[model samples]
Target: MSTSIEELLRFEEERPPDGEAERQGWLRPVLRILAGAVAIVAVALVALRTVGLQVSIPVLAAGALAVLGVRRVTAALSPPPPPAGGGRIGGGEEEGLYNWGARDALNAAVKRWETPLDWSASRPERFASTVLPRLAELADERLRQRHGTTRESDPARARELLGERLTAFLDNPPRRPPSPRDLAVIVAELEKI
Candidate 1:
């Protein structure tokens, strides 16, 4: 019982709208407007206060906070740079292959290489291609160390090493650096490895 073209069009029009689409459509503009309003109000208040007007201290403090907030929000929206190196640090593709040139300093070198990359302010691609690999390797090593060398046998361990957050990031790389919280979480996980 297919409807006629006119009826179909009417039915389509009567259908409930997509809530997610509506929210997404308004999100960006709303944020921009809010940011603009904050900046404008802050500037205006600060300017008025500078002109010998008896502006309240609280007003000045609010303006300063607004300006700082706006700046931080804007900076957070900026893009990240590209990654370098073959994405490998100390533990290259051949983890078991590479022999430490020095004997006593091997642990030190591993420790140095294990140092987590700062994703809080690093490029997304750079984090994935460079920093992520090293962290993944660390996770892998930790897994290996814990339950013996069975990377193929241990799916759960591999997932843990990949990390829920890191897996999402790597699966769909961000256009900008990760948030400070995300970076910290990933770094902490890698350090544990």
Candidate 2:
């Protein structure tokens, strides 16, 4: 059997009956506060019995006040939360709700580019398998768009147009990470192609 779109989109929460919900709205907080008060009072009474009542009561009160003071001071010292949708440092501006995957991918790419030595050392297979294929594809796409042929279709002409550095890198990517200047030159040559 099939379900209607309306059924799928409908709110699925199992809400309590109106009367029960209203009863619980006030009841839960009241019960919680009452329980906490009972616990505090029990502790206070134990202190009073252990020491003399006057000394114990004042000491308990002072302890409670100190806790409150420390909490307030800590709260004041702590930094406020970032405004919603505010991007983090070195990251791009936040996109609405479900863009975390895109942001994460972008951040990972940036990190990979930022540390070429580590990336090449740690993931040498990715360098040859992933990066080379992508660069080759880009070069082929440019050649096809501008000259009506790809590297495979017309290697001699494509290599001349693509230039020595880019052609060599695409044909056989180096085992060591290329310097930023070398990469930039290759990218510039690809754009020219």
lDDT, candidate 2, 1-193, per-residue tens: 9999999999988876799889999898667655655566568878777886654555555666566556655655564455577544445544334334333444555677686544454677766766668778999999999999898998999888888778888887888657668777877888887
TM-scores of all candidate predictions against the true structure: 0.29, 0.38
Clashing pairs in 1: 83-126
lDDT of 1 by residue, 29-73 (tens): 668766766676677777887897777656665776677677766
| Residue 63 displacement (Å), model 1 | 59
lDDT of each: 0.62, 0.71
Model 2 TM-score, 2 decimals: 0.38
Which segments of candidate 1 are over 4 A away from where they belong?
A: 1-122, 149-153, 160-163, 166-175, 191-193
Per-candidate RMSD, Å = 26.1, 22.8
Q: Looking at model 2, which ten-residue stretch has the lowest summed lDDT?
A: 94-103
Top candidate when judged by TM-score against the true structure: 2
